[model samples]
Target chain A: MSLLAEIAVSVLIVIGASFALVGSWGLLRLPHLMARLHAPTKATTLGVGSVLLASMVYFFAIGKGVSMHELLIVLFLFLTAPISASFLARAYLRAHVAPDVLPPAGEQGWATFARRSDDAHDAPATSATRAPPQD
Target chain B: MSDAGLLDHALAFGFVAFGLALLLNLLRLVKGPTTTDRVLAVDTMVIDVIALIVLLGIRQSTQAYFEAALLFAMFGFVATVSFCRFMLRGRLVE
Candidate 1:
């Protein structure tokens, strides 16, 4: 490999590794589940993406031709990370927070853990009164 | 210094850094207060592990590990989705 290519690979690897390190640090030190969620999903995704880019560039420079497989992992991570985060957020809301405590959802109703309008209609009107709002 | 020597040094540094990140992620996984936090830790670990595998592939100049990394990403996504689904629905299957 050429010296220039080696330097580029080194820079990419270091940046990627640093991002990963900061991301895990956030995970360890963040105060709450909601706050901690932001750290890993965004930073770790970028961290891994950068590292994969380094690998692709390194292989290309080494006369191994072009390797496109790493792109698959990048695509998968981007697509799934937000979805899993969303699911977890909804789960946390459903288990811990009462519907009335949530910020009003306007005309559409609660964004997550929305009881079906029909179920809302059939249940005792006092159901909302029984469960105290958390936070 | 030779190009190979530089590359070797960089790879060594990368391996150590990524290994440390992985260990810290495990720490969060064990100590996280909520199930959601643990799930997020595992999610981050999966990404870090993928990065480590790609770094290893670069160091070794091998293409075989690419497929392993891709497979691992797929598995991690599936696991996260299912775990979230269970948490959301209170059951794995409908």
Candidate 2:
């Protein structure tokens, strides 16, 4: 590889690795679950995206032929991270928070708790109510 | 210096950093107050491993790890979604 390409690859790798470390650190240290959810999903996604870009460029510079397949991983991560985060959030909500405490959202109520939250007895209070989920 | 001088140093740094990140993720997995936290930690660990695999591909200049990384990403996402789904609905399919 040429000098410029080598430097670029190194820089990208370093940046990607640093971001991954910081994101994981945030995941471990953040005080609240909601705050914790945002850290790795965003930072590490970008972290790996950088590494993938670096991989494409490094291989191209080494005369291995152009390969654009890494973009598929980037695109997949972008599409699914949020969906998973939403699922985790809904899981947290369904398992922990009482629905009545939530702000009103029409007759149907919020989709997460709408089916079971109305009964009140089912969820009770917080995760302590994990027993007898009923279904 | 050498032909692979700066690049080798960077790869070493990258490996150590990612390895440490994985350790931190494991710590979170162990100590997380709730199940949601553990699932999130594992998801992050999978992503970090994918990135590590990409770095390996770059280091070896091989194309094989490319498919591996992609498959890891795909499997990680599906696993995370299913775990969350099971948690939310109390059933994997509903």
Q: Per-candidate interface C-alpha RMSD?
A: 4.5, 3.4
TM-score of each: 0.88, 0.89
Tens digits of per-residue lDDT for model 1, A19-60: 888888888988988888888888888888888889888888
Candidate 2 clashing pairs, residues 3+ apart or interchain: none
Best by DockQ: 2
TM-score of chain A of 2: 0.82
| Real A-B contacts recovered, model 1 | 0.69
The C-alpha stretches of model 1 lying farther than 4 A from their native spots are: A116-135, B1-4
Give the per-residue lDDT of model 2 (tens digit) for A18-92: 999999999988999989988998898888888888888888898988887888888988898899999999888
Q: Give the clash count for each candidate.
A: 0, 0
Best prediction by lDDT: 2
Worst 10 residues of 1 chain B by lDDT: B85-94
Per-residue lDDT of model 1, residues B11-83, tens digit only: 8888888899899999999998778778888988988999989998887788889888988898988888887
Model 2 lDDT at residue A31: 96
Query: Residue A96 in candidate 2 has what lDDT?
Result: 74
Give candidate 1's total backbone clashes: 0
Candidate 2: lDDT of A34? 87
